[model samples]
Target: MNLGTYLTRSARYWPDETVLVCGERTWSYRQLDCRTNQLAAALIGRGLRPGDAVASLAWNRGELVETEFALYKAGLMRAPVNARLGRGEITHILRYAPVRVLVFDAAHREDALAAIAAAGTDCLPVPLDDVPGDDVPGDDAPSDEIPAAGPVGVPYADLLAEGTGDPVAVEVDEDEPCVLNFTSGSTGALKAAVQTFGNRLANMRKQLMSDESRPRPGTRYLACGPITHATGMGLLAGVFGGSTTHVLPAWSPEAFLETVEKERITATFLVPAMLTMVLAHPGAADRDLSSLTSLRIGGAPIAPQRLREAVALFGPIVAQGYGLGETTSVVAGLTGQDIARAVTEDPELLQSCGRAAYDTEIRVVDEAGRELGPREVGEVIVRGPDCVREYWQEPELSAETFKDGWVHTGDLAWMREDGYLFLVDRKKDMIISGGFNIYCTEVEAALYEHPAVREACVVGVPDERWGEAVKAVVVTHEGRAVTPGELIEFCAGRLDRYKKPRSVEFVPELPHNRNGKLDRKAVREPYWADAARRVN
Candidate 1:
C-alpha cells in the first residue's frame, strides 16, 4: 500500500477545492495531484529507483509540499534537511544519505552548491523558483513565466512540465523506510529516526481518529513553522481530510496574525517559542482571530502560565502535544477543553501533558525496565505503531535508545494515577545537588508564575558545596521589570527550599534551537565549562 493513493483519492473527492496555499500561490486538489504525479514520473524517468534517497533543503514553500507527496508516489525515501542547518551539517546529511537529488529554494542555493561540492557525491540539484503563480498544464492556463534556472542542476518547473499528468503508481511495502526524520542536534550530532511508510500511515490515522485535533472538511490548517519538521507532520492528516493547507514562508508575528485573519484559518500549529512571540506581539489584541478553532502548540513544553495566557487571548482554543521525531506522531495531548477545565476545576492538570494518546503505551520506567507507579519519576518510554524502532544507519546508537519494543525517551517524567504524563525534566538536564534531585522544569514553572517573567530557562551550575546548584536564566516582558532577588523570593514561595533556584540572571532572550525549543544544552555550557565533568 502507498500513502500517495490517499492523495489521489482526495483529489477525486475534492477536485476543485484548494489543497495548498503558500504566499500568493494556491493549488487546488486537482492541480496538486496532477503536478505531484508529473514530479514522480520525472524522478523515476530520470533514473531514480524506488528506494533511492531524495532530499529537500528549503524553507516552507509549495515545492517542499509537492516533493513530499511526489516521493511517496515514487517510493523514494524523503530526507528533509532543516533549512536552518549550517553548511557543514548539510554536507553531513547529503553525504550520509548520499542523496541522489537535492531540491532547494533560491535562498539556499549557495549553501546547497557548497554542500554538494564538499560531499563529493553525484547529487544533482533541483532548484525551485517559488514563482507564486507558476503552474502545471491543467493549472490556470499554464504560467507564461518559465521555471527559473541556475548555473547547475534541473529546473523544478521543467520536470513538472515534462510529466504526462498521469498518476505514477509504485508498489511499496508498508514496513519500508519512507522518511529519514532528523533531529535538530541540540544534544549532539544530528541523528535520524528512520520512519517507515507504515509508521507515517499510522501517524496520519492517529490524528484522524482522535477527537482532540482531527482535521475535517473545510478545515484550514495553517503551518507557521518550517514545513520540513514537526509542524509539517499535520499536513498528512490535513491532506487526507481534504483540508486546505496554508504554508507560511517564514514566521513572524505579523505574518501569522494577518494570515489567520485573512484566511479565516480554522486550525494552526506553533511551537512554544512561536506562541511566546505571538502572545507578546503588541497587535495580537487587534487581530480578528475569532475564526480560529484549534491552536496546537508543540516542539517544546510551554510554561503553564504562558499556556494560560494563550487560552485567555485565543478564547480557550489552545492545546498542546507531547512527542518527538522518534515517535512520528503525538504520544499524548492536552486538549483545549482539558486546559479550560484546568483553569476552572483541575488547576493541577495544567502541569500534565495529558494521558497516553489513542493506541500509544507510555511508561515511566526504572533502569531495570520496570514500570514505576504514580508520582515516581523515571525515564519515559513509549511503544506504538507511531514510535520508530531504529535510526537510519546507527545500530549501536539505535540499540541504546530503542530497547525491546519501546523507544526509551531520555525525558524524566512521572505518571499520575489517571495516566497523565507530567514531565519533570530531561534525564541529563536534571540537577543533582548534594544527593537531592532538582528538575529544572519544576523550578522554571515556579519562575513563570511571576507576573513580570515572560520566558525562563533553568540549568545547573557547578557549586563547591552542593556539587551543582540550580540557576535561572530569565527574560521578562518588554515593559515589565523584576529584580533577581524579587524573582528568587517569588519562586521561594512556590517551590521547595531545595527546588527553588539558587540564583537568577536577567537576559534579553534565551537561545532556541532551530526547531524553536529552548536550548538548555547551550544555556548550561558556560556554567559547566570549567567543571571536571560536564554533568556532575
Candidate 2:
C-alpha cells in the first residue's frame, strides 16, 4: 500500500481533529487528507509518474507537509532542496536530480528562476502564490490533462483547485525511489541518497514503535527546525498516531518557547544548536513548558553538559538519537529515562548515543568490515530496513557506502558491552556545524576561487551556541593581499551562509605530509587540541 494510505485512515478515524498547524492556519485531518489527495491527483494530471522527481524550495510551511504526502500518493520522488543553500548549490541539485516540477515560494523566487536557467532543465515552476492563472507552462508536456497555469507555471492554489478531490491510489513497488535526499559530498560534488519507498515505510514503523520518537494521540509536535530535514521527519508519524504537528514558520528561541506554551505542544525535535539557544534564552524560565513530554535531540552529537542543563530546566524529558540521511530513521536512541539515569547514576551513559534501536543492527567495525569487540573504536556501520541502498546515479559511491548489505556511516565510534555508541571522531572529510554537514573540500573549493587564497583548510572549531563553528585557515599568494573579511564574504557569496567560515586566519605556511598532500588533520589538530572528543 502507498504510505499516504495512513493519512486517509487518519482522516476517517479523526476527521475533525487538527492534524497540522502553521501560524494562523490550521489543517484538520479532513482538510489535509482531501488537499493532499487533490494535490497528488493534480501532479498526476500534469503527467508526473511514479519514480519521477518533484522538488520543493521553501521555508517550513504546511504546504511542504502537504507536498510530502501528495508525492507519496502520486508515487513521485519528493526532492526537498535545502532552503538555506545558495543559488549555485540549488542549481547543482536541480541538474543532479531528475526533477520535473519545482515548487517554491516568493522568498526564493529569483534564486529558483536563476537555478532553473543555469540548470537548463525543462522543470516546470509551481509558485506558491496567487498569481494570474493563464498561459501556464507545461501545456504540451505529453499529458492528456493539464492544470490551469500562470506566467511562470501553474500557481500553487490554481494547481490545487485544478486537482480532482479524490484519492489517487497509484500502485508502486516498495523498491521504487521515494525521496531524493541531496547532500554535499567530500569530493565537492552534490549527491542524493535515494530513499526507497520501502525505506520510508520502515521509517514510519520505527517512529511508531520507538519510545523516544513515537507520537501519541492528543500530542502536538512542534517542529523547531527546517521541515526539509530532521525536524520534518516526524510529520507522517504524527498523523499516523493522531498528533497535531505545529510548524514554526521561522525558528527563534522566543517563538519556540511561545509556541510550546500556546499550543501545549507535547513532543518536538530540535538540533543541539536550537536546544542551546532555548536553554540560553532569558525568557525560557518564564515560559510554561510543562506541556512538552518529549524534547528529542539529534542532527549532531550534543554535548553531555547540554543534556544535563536541559533536564534541569525542562524536567526529565530530554532524549537523543543518532542517524543520517542514508539511514531514513534513527537507528539508535537515548531515551528520557536513560538521560535521567545518566544524570543520576551512570555519568558515562550520557556520552553515549543509546543502543541499536528496534530492528536496526549497528556495529563498530574495523577497516576490513570486521565487527569489533566492545569498547573497541572503529567505523560505525548500520544495517536495517530503513537504511538506503544507493545514491542517486552514483554507483561507485553507492558501492563504497552501501556495501555487503550495510550502510558504512563514516563516523568512528565505539560500542559499549551494553550496546551504547560513543562517537569519538569523524572518518569522513566533513564537519557538522549547527547540524548542517559541511565537507572540507567543498568549502576549500569555494575559498580557492578567491585570487589571494593559495591554500585553504576548513575545519570545525568548538562553539558554544552551535555544536561547532566553521573556521578557515588560509595561506595567501605572495603579494596578492586579501583581508579575512573579504575572503569570508567571498565564500558567503559562493556558498550557503551557514557553510561559510565563521572566522578566518591567515598562515604563512600550512602543514603538509611527506607525500606533499595538504595535511587536513594537522590543520584541524590545533583547533581541537583542547577538546576532549575529536568531534563535538
Predicted candidate 2 versus true structure: per-residue lDDT over 333-390, tens digit per residue: 9999999999999988887889888999999999998999998878999999999999
The residue-level lDDT of candidate 1 at 263 comes to: 94
TM-score of each: 0.95, 0.79
Top of the candidates by lDDT:
1
Q: Which stretches of candidate 1 lie over 4 Å from their true place?
A: 130-150, 184-187
Clash pairs of candidate 1? none
| Candidate closest to the true structure, highest TM-score | 1
lDDT of each: 0.87, 0.83
Query: Residue-wise lDDT of candidate 1 within 37-129, one digit each (tens)?
Result: 999999998899867889998878898999999988998999999877888899999988849999987667777777888899989888887
TM-score of 1: 0.95
Clashes of each: 0, 0
